[model samples]
Target: MKLLLTSGGIRNASIHKALLDLLGKPIEECAALCIPTAGYGHPMGSPEGAWRFVTGRRSICPMVELGWKSVGLLELTALPSIGAARWEPWVRGADALLVNGGDALYLAHWMRESGLAALLPSLEHTVWVGLSAGSMVMAPMVGEAFIETRPPITGEDRALGIVDFSIFPHLDHPGFDENTMACAEKWATEIGGLAYAIDDQTAIQVVDGEVQVISEGNWRCFAG
Candidate 1:
């Protein structure tokens, strides 16, 4: 399986191009499965909010030009088994899994409850794409120092574990400071996994389980 962990959206020309190259298709020809805010459940969001977010009329514009089949597990409230089946097949048949940005803890919970965590690893054929919180949650620990909101973090810090190391997204971007980087490095040292401090414009792609750093900007990795 291939994993691409990115900062925000595919707005960066290099990031967008990398996604296209990895999927091995024209953007429109590929199907994308988005898992936004997985733990809190889709019912938590008012249908209107869910619609706007998925359609990308709000924060972090979604790359809809890349065929996005709305498999929003949270949005399907009061549904039957058939509904899950409907959602599953599109994702199962898709070329890639595109996890949208949201609260990292919530997204992780959703993955566990929605059975995506189990299913994803088994699907060796599909590419796993995570953006922002999506990328953050895939690591062993998401750097809470980088996230602005204080979501109710439960006792656990288990991320998707798609990558062996933990990552902090948007590091060194304009407003961020070296202090935050220090905090992240400290956290990684405590966790005993490598820490990748990534800039917003950068991307770390793992193909066949090997990670390749792809970006012009600089990033620092802490491992001990």
Candidate 2:
């Protein structure tokens, strides 16, 4: 699978280019699936938030609003009861999966329950375009600091571990006081592994087992 992990969605031309490169095609020619499950897991995520993302109404995170050939919603919570036979094909057929932001653990929990985590290794041709928590869910772990949703719903900060490093997204955003460089450094210290602190204009791309940073704003890497 091709990964374009971003702090925000394609906020600049470079990230958009990176996304196009991952898709190997234009946005207008590709089919996409909008996964808004992550939002439901956090206070930041609400029905209005999910609605904005699915309908392409968001201003900052422009996942669904990117003008794809076609866009469909793939809520992870619903996949469990529907059976794999009905939903697996939809995943296999999409060119890219546009995952939303909110809570990584909540998203990770659903990914496991919905069987999407196990199925991810098989989607070799697909592109995963993630926003904030959407991207964090791909990392090894988000650390306790990022764990907003807790307990029986999701007990750990650990995610899929598909990627070798952790991510501190939304760095230096005016809206989030805790998303500063100092906070990221503290988070990185807890992670004790390779991690990237990226602002909204930055992105971490992984393809063919190689990771690359693509940015138009600010970013830094902390090595273990």
Candidate 3:
């Protein structure tokens, strides 16, 4: 599957262009599904937060309001009871998945439990547009510093490992003073693996196993 892992969604023209390139079509032609499962796991996550994400009221970027052909909700927590045969078709038919920010490990749990993780290997044509924790979930680990809620199955810091690195999102954002470059450096050292620290205007794109950093703002890569 194609990945567009973002710190704060498409905050700049470059990131938006990268997303378009991944979509391989105009936004109006693509069908998208917004996933809000991650938000529910976070301490700050609320019903209002999930609603904002689904309605694009958070204003991180176009996201759910991207003028797609259609936008649908994909609540991972509800999938287990519904059966894969019913929801699998919805995922396969969508051109992209817009995942929201929250607890990465929590998202990882549901992805596995809901059968999405197992199905990821076959979603070669689908693009995953991830915001914050959504992006972090693709990493091998998000590091202990980012853990809000410890996922029951995976280790405290470990994640989905779909990508070969870790991510420190919201780098240097004024609203999040803790997301400083120094903090990211500490996280990199603890991670002890390939990782990236990205600000709101940056994103990491991975397609066909090739990784590229797309940014209009600050970013840094730390090698293992």
Candidate 4:
């Protein structure tokens, strides 16, 4: 499977190029399904704004500008329960899956309970694009440091384990809460495993088990 995990969304030409490369086709021919379930537990000024934030319209705008034909939002929470038959076709039909960031544990919970995790491995042709909590949920566990800002809703620490290493998103982002280099360092040390600290301009690209760091700003990896 191909994964483009970012702290923020695509913020530079190189990351955009990396996404295009993963798509293996012109943007106009690609279709993407944006999953915004992660943002449900987050604090927001208004429901509408929260919806917009979780939908990640700003992040998907670049793809639209590049001529991406179809980009739509999918809220897994709207479903009655865990069932692949209802959503599997939508996921399979999309060329890419864009996951937004919010509460990692919440996202992981829905992914597990909704059977999304089980369907992911079969989506060999779909590129997985993750932002913040979206990236974190793919790892074995999420960094505890984020609890300082947003508490966990699922009460579960373990993530999907789709990827071996953990990710610390928005590292050193002054405008965001619970996002500092020191927090990343502390979380990496606590996890006692490899963790990547990536900022808005950086991303980790994984393809067929091969990992590559794509960045336009700065990033660091902590080995614990």
> Candidate 3, residues 1-224: lDDT per residue as tens digits?
99999999888889999989999999999999999999998999999999999988877555887789999999999999999999999999999999999999999999999999999989998999999999999998888887888878545677899999899999999878789999999989999999999999999999988999999999999997
lDDT of 2 by residue, 58-154 (tens): 9788888888999999999999999999999999999999999999988998899999999999999899999999999999999887898873643
Better of 1 and 4 by lDDT: 4
TM-score of each: 0.77, 0.97, 0.98, 0.89
> Residue 165 of model 2: what lDDT?
94
The pairs that clash in candidate 2 are none
Name every residue pair that clashes in candidate 4.
none
Least accurate stretch of 10 residues (summed lDDT) in model 2? 149-158
Local accuracy by lDDT, each model: 0.65, 0.93, 0.92, 0.78
Which stretches of model 1 miss by more than 4 angstroms? 38-52, 58-62, 65-86, 143-154, 176-179
lDDT of 2 at 37: 94
| Candidate 4 TM-score versus the reference | 0.89
lDDT of 4 at 209: 85
What RMSD, rounded to one decimal, does every model reach? 4.2, 1.1, 1.0, 2.8
The residue-by-residue lDDT of candidate 1 on 117-216, one tens digit each, is 7677767767777776778777876654534334355646667777887777776666656436776677666767687877767778888778887776
